[model samples]
Target: MAEGKVDPVHQFTIEPLFGTDHLSLAGYNIAFTNSALWMAITAFVLIVFVGGGAKQALVPGRWQMAVESFTGFVDDLLRANIGASGRAYLPYVFSLFMFILFANMLGLLPLALVGLHPFTPTSHFTVTGVLAIISFSIVLIRGFTKHGFHFFSLFVPHGTPLAMIPIIFPIELISFMVRPFSLGLRLFVAMMAGHVLLEVLSGFVISGTNAGALTFGIAALPSFLLMVGICALELLVAGIQAYVFALLTCVYLNDAENLH
Candidate 1:
């Protein structure tokens, strides 16, 4: 039982807050689980951070500065990638970036400190998949609405020969269709792999100490040091993944709008 309990993959399990039994509403499973809890926490943090910083003053506080800096960063990203037309989607892009950023960062914090289940929603395919699907849906809708059947031209290269067009179209179509799954899988795999490594190292620290004090220190030191290094890398990954997701969304939007 102890061996089974020490599994690193156990950390990813979704347990219902209300207990083993789940609640169903209108054919939907509405049980509040650990994933749902973290999601709510992420949303609350976003609301507080943005709302508290909404007070525009000449000299801004730390929170206000953070909010403004993030806003400016997203603004610059959109301007550089999607140009003037991207300005309209600013709210959406910014929101998605911040949400993923917060979710990733919050996952790094010890759940014991926050009194919540230590779970990363972004590590799960469901959450990331939904985000990717939404972005893809927006692109499809915008593209079809704006350009109609001509939107299909996005899959064709501008100067392709008629003979090559037949070959390239299906390839491009498959690639385009794979976008959302690829996006979600990238984030999910990265987040899940990092967290599992951390959990495994943590387990080593505990099992090592069970033998003797000296062995505990010897085992724990390197493990702890490596965990710190990994944590730093995870922080970088968190930001990069969020930015990549947002940037890809912008690129898709540009494709929709400009057939690029």
Candidate 2:
């Protein structure tokens, strides 16, 4: 029983929720993963919010009010950045915001509940990289569609000297590509590092019992405090990351529309 009670930090072994052997799908085995579960939950919640809000009343209920607030906020953000032109992309932006917001928030829940899974998809570079690639593709396609081949002019700054074209163009192109990489990495690293720190501190608390009551108490205090601070920070980061993503999208759209 004592052995069974080993702290999770000490037993950091992760077992895949879905195994290839279980599915026997030859080269393609899709197992039900915890990350998949949370993503589904996020999608369901988003649908409910949007669907419920569409049937608005004079006196809205809690869910309706909540949805309204988010919609209003996103609408205002779009109006400010892209003016009336941004209206068409509101649904996509809102969905992006809500999905990421929920993903970050859900990740902060206790490990025993949401974080115990073998695969943290958000922490995985592949997941974030894919999301980044999708956003990049959207920007490129929209820009080209709206501005014709002139969209390539984005790689050349407005006042760039003719002689500097070789140097500046490559730099601008690299910078554009870096946008998605930085966006995805920022969120993934924050989520992964915060959780890992919490787990490490928790391990200290669990393992220090044999030391003295004072030792355990001292070890626990900072850990608890850090956890609380990080939780608050995570909440703020969730919104900020979502906003940054949307803002970048808008900027890319603006470039597409203006061919700048």
Candidate 3:
């Protein structure tokens, strides 16, 4: 890092929106942070969707149609993977998708344009880790409740030899246990990498602008173009990642209930 260069990781810093960022009670720092603000914003957006769509217009206006279409998409997704039983979990699955989708897309928008910093909560491991943990917990509780001891069979190979059961069991168990970590890491890394790359390329343009017109024309121009392309790609990634996460949830739920 040099002077006039942007720190790619600076965006991920958790700063307090209000004056005092630090407030400790009983040895635990419970200060409100930027991450909390974004989460609140995410919640507010969801509230608007729920409230705004409450009308259930007969003909359906533009915003209403948009809301209904998104809901239908999530419904279709759940039904496709988990079948009719998935409807019961639609609220959880849809909320997860919308929150991530909004966070991801909102993170791409320039703060200057929207008067809001595009801080992505999903880019942080803690946020995504909690989501993974919840998904994992659901798998455990529902799997066991639905099928009892048979849920353990998820780790047992369908056609493995009796002698190899001892060897295969541990490997499968480890893989099953690591699902949450893998899920969280995948989303966090993807988001963080894209944002870092965007920052780095924008830094190049900034440095090029300061150098001279020649450098700005040659280096900054191409860098800016690439940044634009990457921004477009990130938009696609935001939706795809959200869908992937939700789909995986349904798949895991399917495994828990059906035990395949």
Best by lDDT: 1
Of the pair 1 and 2, which is ahead by lDDT? 1
Q: Give the runs in model 3 whose Cα sits over 4 Å from its true position.
A: 1-3, 24-26, 114-116
Worst 10 residues of 3 by lDDT: 109-118
lDDT of 3 at 194: 96
Q: Between 1 and 2, whose TM-score is larger?
A: 1
Clashing pairs in 1: none
Task: State, as a TM-score between 0 and 1, how close model 2 is to the true structure.
Answer: 0.85
What is the lDDT for 51 in model 1? 92
Give the 10-residue window scoring lowest on summed lDDT in candidate 2: 1-10
The alpha-carbon deviation from the true structure for residue 71 of candidate 3, after best TM-score superposition, in angstroms, is: 1.5
lDDT scores in order: 0.89, 0.71, 0.88
Could you give the candidate ranking by TM-score, starting with the highest? Answer: 3, 1, 2
C-alpha RMSD in Å of predicted model 2 compared with the true structure? 3.3
Runs off by more than 4 Å, candidate 2: 1-26, 111-120
Tens-place lDDT digits, model 2, residues 1-260: 12223443333333345453345357675555566666777778678767988766889888788889998988887787778988888888787777777777766666666436433456655666777777778788888888777887899999999999999999999998898898788767766776677666666656554456896678766666777887788678767777777777777666665665
True lDDT of residue 76, candidate 2: 82
